[model samples]
Target: MESIQPLIDKAHELIQRADQLQSKEPSVRSVPKLSKRIKAELNFLHTLQSGDVELKENQLQSTNLTHLEAVLSAAESLPGVSDIFSAKHATDEKGNQKTLVIDVIANHGAIWVKVTARRGHALYRVWQGEGDYGDKDIVEQALEYNNFASSNPVKFIVPKVHVMFLKGLPSEVKGELESVGIATHGHVLSNTDDHRIDVPCFDWSVLKELKVIHAGDPRRNRVNLDVSTMIAMTSNLTHNGCWFDYPECLLINDQAIEERHHPQLTALYDILKGKQLFACSTAITIYKDIVGNVAGPMEQARAKMLLTKVRIVDDCVSKRTQELGWSNKIKERPKIIFGTGDALEMVTVSANGSFIRSASKHNITYAVDLHQSRAFTERKEAQAVTIKKDDAFKRINLEQILRDLLNPS
Candidate 1:
């Protein structure tokens, strides 16, 4: 703990004194020799100072690793966690390969975890470090691991720390992490005995009977079921009832009496005859054409039957609705509240990626685009584990999508 700087300074002073003495008394042969010795000793002192700084750094690194090991050990002891291993690496923004710790599978899926010994300002400093050194590495690694072929999907890469500030993680930090699909845990003081893994609660099995209809062409006049539609359908099904979304465009364009009947519309109406059907108020406008001399008797009969099943809803609070007004007073009087534009926008992104949006203010739990187009497929927000059209109907993908939709965090 003593000052090594004083010794280094003293050595430098001696070297200067010896150089001056040698210049003043050149004939005194030992003076030049003494200066050489002093210079050599100064260099040795400098080397010792360099080694001392390195020793302290190594000690700090060793302490960090010790804490990380403790965290990993605690994680392994948690119920349902197994096969814990490490030495996995990810590239930083500077292309430096940084090693992460503790890859494990706990109850659900594979998780790549990074353990941090830092707390409060230190932890935040590392997270906000230049060129994506801390949090970025974890995200990059988890994303890379997800790309590899594996049966168990990687849910998220977590940063587990032993301690945090009394108020807990800053909202900004938590928000940023969640935005990029990262999760966090372990803010308690370093106590392995009381540790618990915070797994997300979701009933993925509810989506087992989910039906996905994909239209090959984007321009095709197919049933476009949005997030509100999916939530209505799934919520009803969860409660032992059936519900469906019948868009106004589909119903108006596909009206037919006999052999030329649209198979999709016919099938949808047949499946949801006695069950609940959600449609925009515009759907009720078809009744005018049916009642007037424009429609045949068969069309009028079909329109009357469909009107009884459809529940008209105001999709948004836009001026367009105000301008058009409600077409049918009897049907659209008690309009069901659907959702806001922001909720729809969030669901739109979630539907494309099959990723959970936990920060959405609305109570939207699920969304579906039955006739998803190429635009949805091309979104950069789509996850690496995006369900392909072919696999969209698969039980596993359905379950995953449902879990994502229902995840509260």
Candidate 2:
């Protein structure tokens, strides 16, 4: 190609000369010169060969790491794909340098594929150029990979093996691999669009055969507070006077539809429903003191309704012991029941009931005046307060405090 550069430049020069001559007025002298130059450039071009620009076997090409990573990321998301990792060999056994091997551990019956980035893409054209197809060598190497993987201490039953390719193979080649109880699949990573419908390239059939088991988040079933905590929170709300006194003044206005309590209520509901926290008599005392001034029948009825949702723990000593035992068995510690004033004493009796305490070994109790914290602020609504804690308490909002018995950090 380098040798042909001089000739190519000369041809371009001659074409420009011819173009200049043609652009001039149509004189006999100019027409003859243009024809002569055009003919010379044409003859030179004819002497050039296609082999000059063709890539030779010795030519080296670099893999695009960006494209490779994109392909790997997509592969990682494939159904049954897990534990995608890679290793780099500075020098191979033959003394070749810079070898990278990617291992894709997939499960159904537990299989693994070890491949180079270059050969990894079968269904999707991962790079800019042409794709690779199933080869006999690749098929053989895959067996060795599966064998190596199965030999590990981790137990897996890989009865069948499969070779992957970027492009589909001839029926004869597929039959050859199948003869050994091994399977082969051409590219299934690329998506297809037909009319208005779209189809993905993932092989669903393979996953079905594996019988992969899937599950949702485990903690979804766990609410923020337990039954006892809900009862304590309800008892607290009943005692909190302002919460009942300023229902419309605090959150609801002339333009409001429903009570603004749900935001706070729902936050508490989620925490209580999830059983994230434990509650005690201190929390109950705070609630009772907060709402103790309320004597209105409507207000009392509303308080009773909210209280109904709370599961009050039995006052019985055995039931309390049973509840405490249950809370201790879980992996996570129940949230603390926080309060101020007489809660300073870890143990104390109140006239209303036996001394209530957040005493479960698995749970905690924090006595703090959340209202005195910098995170607590007064809302625009004259009677209401806005409590917003940053970072540490970002998720623990005002309603959550009421429900979960957690003080602002």
| TM-score to true structure, per model | 0.25, 0.25
> CA lDDT, every prediction?
0.33, 0.35
In candidate 2, how many Å is residue 349 off? 45
C-alpha lDDT (0 to 100) for residue 140 of candidate 2: 49
Compared with the true structure, what per-residue lDDT tens digits does model 1 show for residues 158-231? 22211112212434455555565555543432322222333232222332232222234221221223332332
Model 1 residue runs over 4 Å out of place are: 1-61, 86-102, 108-111, 130-168, 186-409
In the range 175-212, model 2's lDDT, one tens digit per residue, is 65577655665443323222123233434244334422
Residue pairs of candidate 1 with colliding backbone atoms: 227-367
Model 1, CA-based lDDT: 0.33
lDDT of 2: 0.35
Q: Where is the poorest 10-residue window by lDDT in model 2? A: 368-377
Top lDDT model: 2
